[model samples]
Target: MSTRNSLRSAFLQLKRRSSTNTGGVWSDFSKRPTTLKINNAPIRQTLFSEGNSEEGPASLTNGDERLAYHSPIAIDETFQMAYRILEKEANSKYQIVDRLEKSLKNAASQEETIEIKDRIDKNLIEAEIENPEVLYNAEFADSKLLDKSQPVYRHLLKEKWENYDLLVTMQRLEQLHVIPDTLPTLVPKADVKVKFTHNTEDQFSKWVTPGSLLPAFAVSEPPTVYIQEFDRVEGSNNLYTVLLVNPDTPDLATNSFTTTLHYGLKNVMLNNVDNSIDVSKLLKVGPRITFKEYTPLTPEKNAPAQRACLWVFRQSKEIGDISEASENFDIREFAATHGLTPIGAHIWRQKFDRSVPGVRQMYGLGEGRVYEKVRSMDPLNL
Candidate 1:
């Protein structure tokens, strides 16, 4: 098989795993390849080891110095109950009728079309508790994981779920329990030399902060034939990019990399963020990249740095080359919904070349960077 084909098959394998895993990876993740850690030693000795391996000292003690960072772990469940009740109340018939009547009066389209859609919206809101019917039933959940023939969920919730009382309740829920999620902290400093940059320290500063998205891509949609698949999910865009920066660096340092990475960038696809719980338009990551650390910077200038280094150029030929390989991805049905013809492999290789960022010299403390920005647990989600 062609090199591209092999890579494409591997991409499909990963998506299958992610879909099968119910736990949504916490808001962030690593860019480094996976490796195992040995944890066979006693917890107390392993955690408190000073490296000298002497018997326990009589008076020496360490607790807070162990680099422990904590966040709320005990989640409050009351908020879930309260939100569900309020959501039901807000979706009542009288409320739906009032909103639909107002929108019908305000629409700009042909009066009949507007009236039809408005009535459908109202009726959907009023009759949502009923089970799915024939070809015209409105879906009413915050999900698009259903078949394309199924409709995306939307209703009175979009217009009415905006009250701040919901926010107030959610914030209060964070206090209900001490749910602490801990992660490794960035190295205080790196003593290393990065060869790729004019000034390695300047580049290393940016890799410490984290942001939105992950590295992913889906196959371009296939050409629609007779009886094209009808998308039950709507309003999802077909392109997306993931930023793998570290947050520990000063904000200004990363500004350049951000612009440099995305400026006038072409061919990269964005994921559909509108209604699905799944990762949309994700590009499959191949084994073309790796991370390398610089040794040290000391004396007149003491410094530590972690740079994202690319070791391989040609990724595996799983099933084919870039485009042909991508055929194994499940991006076509959604594309067909919008009336566009599906794209093929040759175009995908072009996409692969254009979209990936220049990480030849990314530096940072890696994953410990993006700490402050992740959103807290939604009481409703709990």
Candidate 2:
């Protein structure tokens, strides 16, 4: 019993020494105070405390400083707050513009008008600076973000057309012989899109492709033309002339084809944004713009397919009195006489169908003639 007691006492002493000794293997596992006394004050030791001793805790008021200490959730909240502030500022700016425009229209004095115009100019400059991405990243630009009056959006549209639509239009023109057939050649500088919206229920009411074949009923009425100008000249709207001629009008007497002018517009004012010439515009200012009112192409029965060549020209100056459209209209001579620069063109094909007769009667075109199908004896004649 004495020897057992001595062995137990010795074991207890050894365990206590191991627990207290700092050099022992079990010293790290022993219970110790979480903080150390520094200058008679308790200082909590932390992983980051030592490294950040020189700099104090991150600021809660400053966004840049607070972001350093924020978690992902907190960062997201900060971003949303910033977005809301920016949106509010944008709305306020637009409201100011609307108020200014209204005030300008109802200004009482010349001084007031001048002051309002100056403010508007300043606002436009600010908008232009803030909205340059629309021009640079045009391909991914949203249509809702585009402001037609802004030059940046206009330039973007111009670049877009030149990059994609213009190339396709040029290819179609060359392939279909619209260049040589209508005019000797063309150097297009503007983008043109044509559509006939007379019959909304018809399939061709939307913008027509450059070389599409349309049924007679689809294009029985006058077309709406959009001419987008890329070259911008400040404080001046360009004068344009639009001509629609059919280079495939059958001449039964000569056994060949002749050109006929179906529509003509002269001295029509156009700008980057306000570019379309539609029925409403005609109704508003028909006498000033219309050189020759629209006459629908009424193909005779048994006639071959016809090409409706639409041409757009940029005039150096306003054109003077011009003769009315006729069956043998000379497009080239008229363009030369008026110094009209060919800037854009479009074409669509039409053939005789059941709808042609009704369309002719509606347009006041008297009885149409039917041509006999001429056949050749030679197999290679086809």
Candidate 3:
């Protein structure tokens, strides 16, 4: 049937169902007389008990009165603001979907097409419910699509739940160029695993999420890390360099991306250069040469949490010793000059807020000093 005819039929069916349902509820309405009238003697609504206003002009003085109140100006302003935000969001969503759809329509292969389609579907779902709470509450809120490791997504949830410190840290990671702009992007299968290990503890970990204990517990002891790629360099001597930096230092006021180096290690040789060795257990053989020793992360009081970013770069054979490098280390320039390609990176956060006084004391920052530090770090005064 035609669309118009189908709608008409549907409406007729609904009307019939409504009339017949619930013991013929609509039958009483249908049987009511269409014409009805009353004597024009001024109908008296029981304003207060059973009083007639016509008895005396002032007889109904004790009646309850209600005045309709509304703030049309404020309501209109709020509605306009809401509309603008929603409009901007909707426009952004449609643009992304359109762009993705176009790309998929022109996809080269079936495999690529399927991948693109999946991404499109995921985008649509994300746009439909931008709020994390709605998605979290949904029955079909697929865990596969929800990447809590993503800085933005993680921060949204943290902000919703009032995890203030980690939220700032996550945002700082993005701002400092530690994480790529296109992140939450899939890592290629060929990429090697560069993992972190604790010196005091035997357990190893991959991702250092904000919710994890790495933020607080890691400050006690330095963590050991080894890259898998250097071990696999067959019949050739390869050295690696590691550097860690905290961009949120002096957290005194505003977050300045200018960094303070936490640790640096250089001239790292993988196991014995001669014998065949397992790449996975390279740290078990012997400790590599340490250029700069690990310094514990110390964030100032009343500041945003600090992100301790560790970058591992493959040392070029042409470059000599870099042991005397200063704390104001430049990772990008050092990489370029020495032909050092960054193999992997890791990040963990730390904070010295009022909630954790013991942590502040551990760093030798006194209570008076902490208050002074708070004054210095206030962004508003700056």
Candidate 4:
């Protein structure tokens, strides 16, 4: 009986100590040192601190250290609320834009049209400011957002092309001496890409690189071209001219090189969006755009590699009927006469291959001349 009474007394003492130990578990946690020591140097633990108060917990630092704390749940809720508000605002602005566009189409007078256009522009600006990712995110950019009517979209595409495609094109042109060899110089303002889609099985069916080598059969037919004009004026279309010239056409008699015009197109109307020159485009627009039809380059046997330099020009005005392109053509004189401004250029090299004979026959061209391999003579003794 005495031993049992002693055990009960000990349990009561333990319960009293736990109850008086800084109130409870939370109170004890709050009393913990707000700063820890590493290498005898004090480092404040801000993560577990209280509100953003100038004074820390009374139990730590004698209220000298400032404390900042955040709740994960509160932060998550705040972000979600902000995102919803932004989404609603963006949707409202888009609706306004659509309504304004509809009103613009049915505007009674030029003044009404101008007013609607201004409102649309203002709303578009506000929308972009509120949510820039929709306009600037290239990887996930929507096709509708990339409309030619949107100036922001146009600028984004222009920047992308200038930084990548245009830079590479300029470098290749300089390295290949296509500058002085073809025209005096060029200041490209457009993005031009070419591909041969007639033979889908050919490796060159896709857009050809600036200075890549292509087989004769791959380029035996007309090519599809894309010209993107970034400086396009709103509500106005641009007229472009495309010329394909072979600057490495050998002159057996003169033992020099001469340029030959392989394709010439003029007065092709283009805008930021409708910018492809293909068979379908030609059929829809009629044959008026083609001044000189396409004739693929077929280099003669045992001849040097030929460079097909394609140039894109912005015409000052609509050009009248021009003469047919000649085997020996003067590109500089023609450009000056027609008031053509060089805007972009592309190139692909081709050499005499076994497919050359088959391509020539397919195009109804006569057999190519085979030149004998000439040996270089030894240098004279000093």
Best by TM-score: 4
Q: How would you encode candidate 2's per-residue C-alpha lDDT over 7-40 as one tens digit per residue? A: 5456444434333222321112242111111111
Ranking by lDDT: 4, 2, 3, 1
TM-score of each: 0.21, 0.63, 0.39, 0.66
Per the 3 Å backbone cut-off, how many clashing residue pairs does candidate 3 have? 2
lDDT of 1 at 219: 13
Give the CA lDDT, 0 to 100, for residue 339 in model 4.
92
Tell me the whole-model lDDT of each prediction, alpha carbons only. 0.24, 0.68, 0.46, 0.71
**lDDT of candidate 3 over 185-239, digit per residue (tens):** 2121111222344424544344344323344444544555534331224223366
Candidate 3 matches the true fold with a TM-score of: 0.39
**Model 2: residues with Cα > 4 Å off, grouped in runs:** 1-145, 234-237, 375-382
Worst 10 residues of 4 by lDDT: 32-41
Using lDDT as the measure, the top candidate is 4
Over 4 Å off, model 4: 1-137, 141-145, 234-237, 375-382
Give candidate 2's whole-model lDDT.
0.68
